[model samples]
Target: MRKQTFFLLSLGFLSFTSCIQEEAPNAECDIVTCRVINLENYSIFYSRHDAVKEVASTDSVVTFPVRNGADVSAIALELDITPGATVTPASGSVQDFSQDGVLYKVVSEDRHWSRTYRVRFVPMMVLPTEYKFEYYELDPNSQKYYNWYGMNEEETRIDFWATGNSGFRLSRSSALPDEYPTVPVEDGVSGSAVKLETRSTGAFGNMVNMRIAAGNLFIGTFDTQNALKDAMKATCFGLPFSQKPLRFSGDYKFVPGKDFQDRSGTVISGRVDQPDLYAVFYRNTDDEGNDVMLHGDDVLTNPNIVALARLESPLTTTEWQHFDIEFDYRGTVDAGRLRNFGYNLAVVFTSSIEGASFCGAVGSTLWVDEVKVTCE
Candidate 1:
């Protein structure tokens, strides 16, 4: 009887030790605990122990370990709830945690998806930031419009003004004295002697007669020297009509002595019956000792003088008629000829005068307007 009792006690002790060895420390816990972490921004989330673990010993529970700085906003778990296990807080909420090592639950929501209980703690706010510049409108009356410059020992001030038409004007004061000319404007004419009033001078003023003659205004003359040299500089704008081979229409008449050459015996005439011929139309260098003359085989000789155009009028001598003359730069001329250097146009007259007449007598009289240069 003593031996059997000892045997039974030993057997019971062995069975108890075996049962203890078979059960895991985790399996012995009534509730499992876990923590969620955000790796991107170092945010943390705490889980509830009682809410995320199984109550029965047969139930399986998992606990996840998280660090202090981890992102738990999108935390997830792979485990499904065990048959005998119950999870708390059906769905997890991302929030700040007062402590670490929290428990979580893996609970099914529907037939397709399941959610895990989690808490997110973010220390810093995630937002977009940008840099920008401040802009201000320019003030016309501001003192910034003037610039001051210091020379040797003195200072000079320069004023700048932006005009209403988007143009700029500058003024400066000098220590030295200088002479300035008076400017005036009359009937569309503008010069140093005249202040320019009309921007559309081609419509009137010096070009007024040109417009009346041509039925259109040509950009007559600018202050540019080249424009002054080229009588038909305004033709650079464009042609007016559909007529082929652009033409200049005008009327011209000659008087023997008054309009023609005088006693200098240069074979050149003095003036024409129409003063407009010499005054308004042609660019004459005859008075300046340069007379236009024809040279060998398609070459003209002259200095400081360019014949714009010439045309024979079909109008009767009694009536003021119109004529058209076309001039072009591309034409064959003699080799090594100065006249051929810049031949933009040519003008021929029915009456020819000797080269000698240019020095003594005045040239023929011709009135010209309505000049047109067309592109071929």
Candidate 2:
């Protein structure tokens, strides 16, 4: 398996600490920061302007989204390193990457160890038509982390992809992909698809009243801030989407769990579990001119919402089935705003629709593959 890494923005500036190295007692040598920039314009672009995320962690791969018509032949990058590390393709060094990617090497303070990183730039104008999740070669580190991301043909990680497994991993202890709430499955409609499931967290989750974690996947950021105030709204939804998607088509298989429980962990007698699948296209700005985004609490009721699409009812399937859901337009979309990315869109999936509130069964499972965002 190949080792691939990715980083998406979370909108908040993070404060990072660095180690002091005198070139003698130092053994750690690695790249700390990486991003693309326009030397002439003095602009730093770490996150894509077309996406709604920011770098929230240090383990993320540094990616840059370059707009068309910009200087592409010769590119400049911004990077940082450990105190004892010296990087080649040195900081602010100019290189032509219009044809191929460049590898930047960093030598540790001890001068005995080194690591190399692939510096890449991707176009932000053309959003892929759909996702198949087939290009990924999940690393061992990725297995420990329940999140999965998509990349373009150029191998640039798509910021529009995310899942609920991150929230579940906070309590679950399993490290392998099979133990994760969201993972890749060998059996699918075609190639490998993502397997989503609700699982028990042994004693840790139950002690806190969170008994089961319903599997989920969505196009948004997961904010731990909302975990206490409103766990349902914990996963912030929507992204800067340029297209007015009309229909959503995909293939899925579902098997609901046997016992149903709410956030309180109380049994709901005779209540059959239901899966949730929906999409929302809403304005990215509020009436006050400030930026806006939706969460599970407001994805359906946000005043700026132009349209919404949801599965008609609970889908209980024994085998993979092709399904399509049409977006129900509520209000007109702003033509001017659409071009400027004033509107945001999100598509969400969960084994338990009520999973947002930690309400679902433990054994519920959902397998999704080949998701397409239809325009015509």
Candidate 3:
């Protein structure tokens, strides 16, 4: 989230109800938003594969996937500028995107401030068959490890890896992604692995009765629409997966907190927090042609899931241990559907088993490293 615009405005309420309103005279630095429309036509994932569009990563550099002979040479931009401010290269104009890093600028109404944005497009690459969490560069602006992509033997960045940390950082102490519960730990199986801890959501979250957000790492996008109200439904799971995974192997270390309690701070007598680890491969769409992505509530029971792998419980290890879970197929996979991206897969790890419902011990922690997904 490095290239995101900083929001400087907040409001209580306006007495009248009108969609259109007049702008303030001195609100010069009000050029609030900008977007590259028409990106879906050439982009591989406008959001989370087919689950979303337009609302996906508003990252400064957008990648457009053009085929060998397809005509994806131009793109259109849409801007929401200050009332009296001006944006160069006018909106709705089809500008050539054949070069790398196209620059767009916005000038404030009072001529006191200006903003510049760079637009970049990249051709798509094949999704890797395995994930070896090898490469990541720290996002300087947000201080979050945004890129946790796996690399193929050929040293190419795989397109299938994603995480749910972005949603988890919304209510953090400093909006710094590093302050999030899930982050990179130097002492990993390979080089750096992921550390997940169940954390207290602080005063603001307690006011809303959402006292906690468990530290989690998973293969999916965090849809903001559902996270605040119903966290179980908020973490939409799975990504386009074709591999018929047979087993999941990884190394992990876990520690339980001293006190276990529900969101209300009521202690659960004699209870020790445990980490939850699982993987699910399912169909991408339902029979009625609607997109299907499992949530915490339905993931284990969803009929769409063709196979599942869950680690055994009582995960209270202080030393790093190798763990392996076998996938048990529930039904046959349509071979033809595999060629297209009709299958979805999800891998999840949480510090607390009941973290989805905001129930957990704040200090519970889980460290994971060198995950190997064995598939057919």
Candidate 4:
């Protein structure tokens, strides 16, 4: 009886071991069935139909495995055309797939349309980066202007005029009728002929340092007020003198000790009745109310003329002297006391006043050239 019982017990133990091994195989099969491959960032995965598998019915749970760095952000599921072949998520998390990866069934359904799940990643950050003045040149020909190293052009000319009396003369080679004469220099370069001169008392002084170029005569004068006026009005060689008023002159005789009190030289010399004269050129103003002449007492406190170099010499027909008048129109004032007036550098001219004469004449001349204003 004891032997029989032992034999039965051994048999029972063997049976239990066999059952355990069978259960282990079933567990391994379950794991293998749930295994899934991950795919993302691949464009072909979206249209790849034969890449994935469909398992279980619509109510069954599905699982998938993913590789490292695989973007499962977007998932898609394939649908069979049969009535109940459509997929719907069941118990656990739905099978997440990639748009670029294989499609898998989560839960089965019958619809023919495929469904996809998508997630968008946050976009990367980026900074916006000084503005850069375009240079331009005003052309004398065609009265045009060009900008950006001559890449762009326009038809606008800056009106520039000669100062005093040196008239403008157009060169034969000038493309514009009113253009200034330009002379060719070394290395095929060219320069404009703009001369400045101060004449002696009597003789009409030729523009000092006049240069001829392209069959054009560039001349100027300083000294005789008439010469200056003539130059301002001249249209020599088909070049039109800028009708713009640019030259302004004034005359001031000393009031003996009163006006001459702080002056550097003798205010009144013997046998000399010194008369102060100034000329102004402008596009002739028809407004009678506008004063085109000025007087000594009127300009005594004038700030524009205060700093200009004063010309002091005996006027004669045979000799001419150059007086450089560097004007500062920046000090001109519209209205105010003598000490508080401000000046406009752009508007410069002489004011009209009674009893002021130029070389004891109604009209006189002053020569002007190389008129330049800088905004540095």
Candidate number with greatest TM-score? 3
Judged by lDDT relative to the true structure, which candidate is superior, 1 or 2?
2
Which TM-score value belongs to model 3? 0.74
TM agreement with the true structure for every prediction: 0.20, 0.70, 0.74, 0.19
Q: Distance from true position, residue 293, model 3, in Å? A: 2.5
The true-versus-predicted C-alpha distance at residue 307 of model 4, in Å, is 3.1
The most accurate candidate by lDDT is 2
Candidate 2 C-alpha lDDT tens digits along 244-355: 8899888888898998988778889999888887778898877776768788777788888888888777568887888888899989987777765577778888888777
lDDT of 4 by residue, 234-254 (tens): 221111122222232222112
The whole-model lDDT of each prediction reads 0.26, 0.71, 0.70, 0.25
Model 1 regions lying over 4 Å from their true place: 1-246, 258-309, 312-318, 326-364
* RMSD over all Cα atoms, model 1: 42.1
What C-alpha lDDT does candidate 1 achieve relative to the native structure? 0.26
List the candidate numbers ranked by TM-score, top first.
Answer: 3, 2, 1, 4
lDDT of 1 by residue, 28-72 (tens): 112333333223432232222212322222123232323345544
How well does candidate 2 score on lDDT at residue 279?
Answer: 79
